[model samples]
Target: MTKKTQPKSGSEIFVPLNMLKKSPHNVRKTGHTAAEIEGLAASIAANGMLQNLVVEPERDGEGRETGHYFVTIGEGRRLAQLLRVKRRQIKKTDLIRCVLDTEHDAHEISLAENVIRLSMHPADEFDAFALLHNEKGMAADDIAARFGVTPAVVKQRLKLAAVSPALMALYREGGMSLEQVMAFTLTNDHARQQEVWQGLGWDKGADAIRRALTEGQVDADDRRARFVGPDAYLAAGGVITRDLFDDENGGYFADPGLLDRLVLSRLEQEAQAVRAEGWAWVMVTPEFDFRATSAMRRVYPSEPELSAKAQRRMEKQEAEYRELETVADNEPMTEAMKARVDRLEAEMEALRGQPVYGPADIAAGGAFVSLGYDGGVRVERGFIRKEDEAPAAQRREREPEPSEGREGSAALPERLVAQLTAQRTAALREAVASRPDIAFIAVVHAFVASTFYFGNRVSCLDVTVRTVYLSGHAAGIDESPQGRACSDRQAELAKLLPAEVEDLWDALLGFTQEQLMRLLAHCAALTFDAVVRPGSTSSPPLKHAEALSQAVSLDMAAHWQPTAANHLGRVTKAAIVEAVREGVSEEAAAQLADLKKPAMAEAAERLLADKGWLPQVLRLTQKASARMLAA
Candidate 1:
């Protein structure tokens, strides 16, 4: 009887290609085809093999033999290497380097070798992971440790492997991430997946999806928003005046840092409206504030004009029916019925396409600023920059002739100009004087469109004001209206009032730590889970171990809130529990309290003032969580 033993003498040895055997334990499949093999061969020719192959000593019938080796691992790899050497006409003896060990424990060596090498590409790794998990039945943590990766990464990659090959290829090519792939996987419909995937590929598709994600989803009544698309409005830092719009059933503001949640809230509200009564999508932009075309409100044979058209149409239909009745004697009644249905459908289609008097058309128009949704609906209460400026040629054509005594060829009516100028001044004055509690105040210049056809069709009126603090001293700036408005607004508003111009500017910079906490209190309907170090039993609800990787993602400790969080979950859950306890699914309960809603909206509006809400959003995670969460 012979016993297997490690070769102390011939550890460094060579194995001939023919004698070496492939390992049964090896599972990674070679994706390389003939051309790839040749290219790899060429690379090896220029640079010799960099990695050593593991082998086992050959045995005889008695189970005892010389210490020379036979390959137990890297069989395909060795074959490729040998093919290259043979092509170069290199001697077999020249390939002198390989490590040999006993055959008795060959399986363990093969497993150890493969794990140590970790040479597979992502696709290969996917397969390897599948083998390790599905075939070998290893635990996720064990697999993670074996591969030096987080368990989440392993799960995510495995998740990616399950995606449709087309979508997986997009991920492999860096078009999407594991989370995105995971999201895509939730939609079971192959056609829907394809639709969404292709839609994402379009130049505007991603923007649209992003808008939907950020705004929550549009519903019937809310769909017809008073702004260009929600994406654009939110981008512009839409300060939703939720408080002022209430009758009893509706009206509430979205919390700062909760645009997506707010959108969802709004959608649910609109959906309730639809259930109560039918509603349609209304996209309001600075240019147009209602659907350009709506079927519900017909324009063709306008409602006012429909009765006469209906009578005439009925007469035509009756005549056609009579003719069909005559033909029915020769043909099937089904044919006549089919023909009638087709004719009616065509008429309906034509009528549906015609324009109607939308909310925008019915609403009064002026220089008042307004919010528009879907690039067509405007929420006019104040000034709204027009979506479409009159083309230069059109504007020039519309210009009035110059006054006889004016130096310029054309002059504005002094009366009209003076009136507008005075109106702007008064607005500015009102804005400035309203703040008395604060120490200082200022009015920056305001920009307004003038009927003036001259250079720079805009006029600016800038003013600065200040008040003493506890000491009879004051401070304010007038560099630009922006700077001036900010300094003065802060001076007047104090903490109780909504952020003045300056507070809005700061909020745009990002939610301060305190502000994020305040937002969590205000927007309590969303849910999120919290994760912490396994051993950290005493950690603060909001704080985490500084050394752990989780804390690294959340760098600003004081201002720690979830960044890039897209859904409501535990972190949200914790926030709701800690701040507000209304059920996440209950929109009405989640709606800000009547007294608190205005203050929250004011804070949010100020937060959105200058830069809009997007910059503030960028600071938050796409996934909401405490400091302990990580993707």
Candidate 2:
């Protein structure tokens, strides 16, 4: 008898491929996809099978060896090797590495292999990719090929590796999401990344984090940035910040101050060209200001009648077109005939286009050079300064040309002004909503001014202001929070009044002063219209609304938060980014600078919520409410 040693258990074996069989006791039931098998085959062909299949011996009822093994853990991998043999990449008899388990149950082995693994953490994978690039000196494309990923994915992973190490640890500990991690990649400055991360709330979202990090930079599509094209700005030594996570948002100009200088330089150069056209003076501005330009005088270029040759060509083309018309009514025109009509129309139009400007009349006028809507140089020629306006002697001779908008008024950004003012009105309405003191003051003021002043038309105090129908221009105005509160208050007050008009005076006499004042305040609040009608000014009511707003310490943030449906979505991208900078951080706004209008507005709404951000029209010169409340 030999000395009995415990037979080696769970031994590794090089099993012949044909002897491997699918195990009925294996845990996984879902069949492998064809593509999964193909990818596995490709991975195996390149890497030579990195893992072993777990197996156990196959036996009959008498516990006799059946000359085969049942695969437990890696049926998928076994299938891939079979595919390789079918493709002639390997032979069916090729030996495959496997673990032969005799003591452990087959299903338990399969479950352990399948369930005991965790996918590599994103930070780890990112670092591994970075190691390939930084240590191994591998390019993105080469690393991508080795890892079965696209070059862009490799590049992104590498960039994520460059994020602040502290942030990576947070990600590892499961404190931050992959989206939030991607946001940190907008800037390469680790200190900034750490600072922004530390300052934000734990739940701060990706867009908010991105905006805060990018606030100091100008967006690539900013008017000034675009005016100085990215290539030129870079050539001029401007820096740019790129985010690999969101290529759609584009890059940001890290040097906004530098871009502005470049923009003004370009605008001044454009002004010099305008000056050469013999204008008295040329004014350069980054953009037109309505208040600054509204009082100026504008002159027109003298339109000369067409020359004799042009008139003759137009007449001839008209005759030829009539001839073609008669033939076309009978039959379709040949290509040559159509070409003749086109050529005749072109020649005639070219002749008609020759309306020469008499430069002599425009010499007295100067140009206002500024940036246009899409960032091109805009030159408005023949705009005379107020002092340079035509003398009354000359003005009486020529007919005054009709101009767009009121004479001497600058063009307005009508939609933006109205939208902002409407939001302000909503906030103001809420502020005055509960104040009975303001209503009492207005009523007393109106009575004294109207009763004492003999010949006065009305007091500058518009105490009896008219109610505005807001739904026409303000979307969802009727359903606004402020609007609903006012409606509820009004309805409640209405129920207290006598049903018949004859009994109203008796009922009011019976009520407490507080109850009467509540009714008065509700009535006054209904007429509180602070909206600036689009394309027109509402000065008195608006001015009065601001004064009343201070009395209540109106904190609009309590009543309003920016949403795509409300404020940001209605404004320009520039406005949206500016709000982000004011409410969040400059870096955050910078991240949004490159986004199209819709995305920028939505991002702004997220960043500005509960941040005390208010539009220009809604902002007060001072937080009178806060100061008084402190008192």
Candidate 3:
């Protein structure tokens, strides 16, 4: 006798809609929402069921066929079809395709269909979306409608698909993360994207990748872009690349050159208007470094008297502001009231524009017109460049007459005066050295002058204060404890110091002896150095810095502790291991030997923290004794 063969698990069969029943063993506990069912129903009506339902044969207790099927999977599709039938869009007796299976348990079939199936990777989905839109000629809206997603999502997925094929391949191979791959889409240059990927090697993160991709591009939210406005940029034929996936402030302007040109042109127009005011010259630039203006003399703008009407308005505003303050003190202030107060203050300020320069001063001085950080035009007037100064005034400043009632007063050369001042300076130094308290005050004064009154001759003391810019990059230099301590000390001194330079001496005399010493120590501390200049083969100054640190018994460990951001991340694997060994233990260093650079760096940072290990540059040198000359 021949035996009958059973059907495969996925064998297709047609079943009437009325004959199907929802299975109680369905894994998905939640019922479909009306909107979801409607969407599914619409999709089915448009393209028919894309997937066959999984149904098992219903059997009676005697193991006889009941002529009904239980849906172990695809219950959502069943509900959708039922809704369609209820809406009369399809007949209740219509046949639906289904997979016939009864050998497996109902629960097993439901779980396998819902839980065991893996969703498509996002990269593959992106590529598939692109393929449908590009090769199949489907509009974004049509694709979105078919997939039950918004058009914006479809467009974003298409954008992701536009990334370099090489980068996408890396993403597929698990070599890069989704975010890191998304950063490459900022630019469409495949060669550049690959170059950046290789340059980053294994160290770069998503933010770094985005920064590299937008190197020459300006953020659309930048002050210059805001000032120029997007409409103007696009009208000028400048391109902008947007990131739809992430919130990057409307994306980046791809043509920074054009943006800069627009900024300069606008500034030039502003300068031309200022030049018409009878100034000697009007200079325009996007950025103006105050350091560059040190050599020039600043002529203060004379405050112009307000008109009678304006004075009345100002007085009224001031009275209102006072009233608001009193009310705020007694009761809570509303946002609208605060805004009104701010507007009043702004109007008062506008009425008091720049001081009016006299005709003569205007003729001798020029103006600098630039864009402020807020995107508004900033005009600095009445700055007299040295070359533009009158010849008579220049002569008077250059020439000095001999004073009477002094030895050799008839004619003393400039060199002799310099020599005399040099001697005086040396004597002052010796006096200050003997009195450490005064020496401390002097150092503190110099520090304050450099930190707060930078590029200005504002010190009452005869000491010369130099303002030094680091000019070389150092990791975590700003966040170091030493930096924070100095900043705090500066803030305290700034509060104590008199606003006017003439009152500085009196202010210094008021400080207690202990306060004076602490200020002096801080000031002297600023003089210490371990800076390495760029392109320098040897740092002779660093040797002296070590000596100075030793002289003061500098405890750098108290102010600094190594971290990944400041030290470990900046060095090689070998260097990190050595740092860890010196700062922690040999065993700790050994534990980090096999880690990747980033992980090793992090481990080293944590191990070295609070271990009191100083880099060679930060170590103090031994104190040297002075030798007496033999007679």
Candidate 4:
């Protein structure tokens, strides 16, 4: 190994012309303008240069230091001095006044000079924050005070600097907003950050930030779910607690599977109560997924366990109700007079059908009769209780008269079918016309296509439909010449056609009239079944582990029962009304149980309803039910 040696006090310094050359410390030009070298020369000709140059020591021609150095700073002044001496205005032998600093001190001086004079660009400000905080170890608050900016502003700039350089370029160009910048700061994931940046188009306004926030929240929640798996969460650390739940009538959930089991077990119990009571069962899980604000869906024909606990209090209430129902049933001279005469009947039933009806029995019976009157006469067990209530002129049991005109004329499935069909046809026609390349033949074909319901499938020429997305990019619209032609033509056609034309085209693309009719038939069966038992997307009695697992994993709206049932109801109705005049099959109608449960069906149904297909929905359910029964 060689021995180390200290640098010489006056070393032979040689700096390349292009490498670490010195320049004047005093700024010769303001802003971005070039220096006025000619003006400096004229000034030097009038008077010898005022300042001496600064430099590192250098060797002589023989390559010896000679205790001399070359100019490193004030180079312009030195050049001016040389020119003055050559013109005989200054003596060549004059010794220059030189001031020198160490290299470290020189660096600090360079930074200080620029800091005092330079006005920073936004990009520069952002970079400066990163350098100060990350490289120079300055505190953010300190930097903020030094820069005369808020801590938030400094923090935001640092965050902005963290964004991919490509995205920051967009921000600097005015294509992105401060709100979006703040939103982008919420995540460190690169792909998600890019996704948000592109999703917010150039024209996105301040309101777009709310949408970004929502998306960010959704992403953050998904990440949380992945990070906090249910089992791992319960394992790390937890405390079991007790609360005064209405005198300790609370429920229990045990082990990792308890939360997963809650919805199905709760629903099964709810269903049993409904069957016993002859009331419809409804289960709603509001938070269904993981929305922070989501609450459990309130079940109606509420679950016995979840409902107010039936303490002695509720038992006493039920006992009172049973007594009232009995009083109404047995003590009536006329049903209207039963309530008024209940005690009198209790007293008189022992006296062999005593006809002493009291005021109370009269009032109670009158109320019962009032509640159950079939037009005028009240019938109980197929007979009128009082001749006075139904005048002798109308005492005979009246058969439901045949409808004079149309049955439920205002709300008939057939009328709804007509309206929807017309609407769909108009939408299809408009769609075709709006596209420049869409010939009249295409429009007619589309309208004709829409007249048939496609449900989830359609065929265009030979383009067999698998999925139809309303909001999606069109194929063949890239940067190539062919793509450009197709896009420009499509745009021109859109400009030429009526605005509704695109909607009509989309309608055509979605389904044919024939498909709609079949779908309507399916809807009728599902809705009727739902009305009777309200089975979810999955078949009723959803007990299998797979089904239960799916329900829990899915969003609440994605709960198989209600969401599937709801979609079947809506789509079926739309199909039926649209194809009502097209005439659906009365034979061999299909049950709509084939659709996947715990899927996107809820979102689709909501979208369809928003587009106005409620009437068609009713008709489809009826027709499909009628067909199913016939089959």
lDDT tens readout by residue for model 2, 461-521: 4554333446656644544556556545644565465322334445655677688667656
Model 4: residues >4 Å from true position, as ranges?
Answer: 1-124, 148-152, 199-631
As for lDDT, the candidate ahead, 3 or 4, is 3
- The alpha-carbon lDDT assigned to residue 500 of candidate 3 equals 36
**Candidate 1: where is the Cα deviation over 4 Å?**
1-10, 15-21, 25-50, 57-70, 74-96, 114-578, 581-631
Give the RMSD in angstroms, all C-alphas superposed, for model 3: 11.0
lDDT of candidate 1 over 439-503, digit per residue (tens) = 12111111101100112222233321211121111111122233334323432222222212223
TM-score, candidate number 2: 0.48
* lDDT for each candidate structure: 0.41, 0.72, 0.74, 0.40
The TM-score that candidate 4 achieves is 0.22
Q: After superposition, how far is residue 410 of candidate 1 from its true place, in Å?
A: 57
Question: TM-score for all predictions?
Answer: 0.25, 0.48, 0.51, 0.22
Sort by TM-score, best first: what order?
Answer: 3, 2, 1, 4
